[model samples]
Target: MTARVGVVTFPGSLDDRDAARAVRIAGAEPVALWHDDADLKGVDAVVLPGGFSYGDYLRCGAIARFAPIMTELVPAAASGNLPVLGICNGFQILCESHLLPGALTRNRSLHFINRDQVLRIEAAGTAWTNRYTPGQEILVVLKSGEGNYVADPATLDELEATGRIVARYAGAAPNGSQRDIAGVANEHGNVVGLMPHPEHAVEALTGPSTDGLGFFTSLLAHLAEGSPLAGAPTG
Candidate 1:
């Protein structure tokens, strides 16, 4: 059976379709999920695409964290029963929901940055990054105003010690993120929050490179291995 990955659509999400397309391109079935709906539709994994959710009011993803859909997504992902990949605003939501650590603050430059960024994969064992080799650099789109990731020094040390740091900006930190971090994963590697937009870099025709497709393909491989998420409802 083909792996089914759900791409969530929030009120102001702008990359849901692109994310779904990337899933399909990665040899998996793409399912649409809504922010107002709590059901996951039995998907083996979920993708929270980029964009300004709820107009990014209050905070980038503060409002979206309380969305009806997140009620289900949070627990499932937190318990390691589901695999979730959050990008850009979705990353903010993951942090806001407490599924991931750290908060996305304003850029050091205090400007909305939009460009192709290079990231060095620090942990390739995560559900979304398994296809990448450790230390491999991949180029993906980075576009956001509040993309600087910050966490308490103790938490940062723990994340680094446990190999939960998934990726870091190569060379210079575009947003001035501490330690040049770009992404991180939960303890079990089932939940990941990335500031860069991988979904936007999955195709050559429309993206900087096809390197981002690996994130989607990695989830398919994880499901094929009969992970716990493989038992999820497939309806």
Candidate 2:
């Protein structure tokens, strides 16, 4: 059976369609989920696509964190029963919801940064990152205003020690994220949040490299294994 991946659309989400298209191109059925709905519609996994949901009012993802869908997502993700990938604004929401550690602050440069960038996979043992080998570098697009990731020093130390830093910038830090981090995942490896936009990088003809397609493909392969959906690294 084809894996079904859900792409959620909140009121001001700009890249939901792109996310769904990427899922389709990656050989999965794309399910359209609404922010107001709590049901996941039985998807194997979920992607919180990039965008300024609710106009980025109080903060990038502050308002969207309380969206009805997140109520279900929070518990499911915490239980390690679901795999959740949050990109850009979605990453902001994951932080706001405390599903992932660290907060995304305004770029230190104080401006929106958009570019195709390289990232090193620091932890391949995550639901969303299994397609990448540890230490491998891949290109993805990073675009956002508030993309600076921050956490307490102790927390940062723990994350690094636990190998939770899923990816890091390969060159100059684009948003001044701590330690040049581009992404991190939960202990169970089912939840991940990243500053870069992988969904946008899936199509080679449209933009930069197609390195992002691995994320979606990795999830499908994970489900096929018939193992618990988190914590294993992909080859």
Candidate 3:
């Protein structure tokens, strides 16, 4: 069966369509989901694509966190009954939703930074990352004004110690994210969030590279297993 991946379209979402297309490119059925819709249309997975949701009002992703869809998403995702991937502003939403840890603050540069960013896969066991080996590098588009990620020392330590760090900037960190962190997964590795936009890079002709294809494919592989998720990973 073709895994159905839902791409949410919030009030100001910019990449929901792109995410849906990437899912299709990865051989999964892309389902368009509305932010206000409580139902997820039975999608096997969900992607909160990037954009300035709620006009980035009251702070990025702050208002969108309480959307009706998230009421259901938060619990299902937290319980590991569903897998979720949040990109860019969506990452901010996940953080705001408490689905993921830490926070995405204003870029240290205080300017909107847009460019092709290089990131190294640090945890390949996540449902969204299994297509790559640890330490594998890939390029994805990153465009945001508030992209710096910050967390308490203890949380950062736990994330690193628990092997939940999914990806990190390959070189000098852009946006000044702590420890060069670019992405991370939850305890179950079923939920993930990142500052870069993978769906934007799933195609070579239009995007920087096809490196982002792995994220969507990885989830498909995980679902096809027909078993509960279980994997051992090292930090």
lDDT of 1 by residue, 1-106 (tens): 9888989999999989989999999999999999999999988899999999999999999999988899888998999879999999889999999999999999
lDDT per model, in order? 0.89, 0.88, 0.91
Against the hidden reference, what TM-scores do the models get? 0.95, 0.96, 0.97
Q: Candidate 1, 56: how far from true, in Å?
A: 0.7
Which portions of model 2 miss their true places by more than 4 Å? 229-235
When 1 and 3 are scored with lDDT, the better candidate is: 3
Residues 43-111, candidate 2, lDDT per residue (tens digit)? 889999999999999998999999999988899888988989999999999999989989999999999
Q: Candidate 3's error at 57, in angstroms?
A: 0.6
Kindly indicate the candidate among 2 and 3 with the higher TM-score.
Answer: 3
Tens digits of per-residue lDDT for model 3, 16-118: 9899999999999999899999999888999999999999999899999989999888999999879999999999999999989999999999999999999
Give the C-alpha miss distance for residue 57 in model 2, angstroms: 1.0
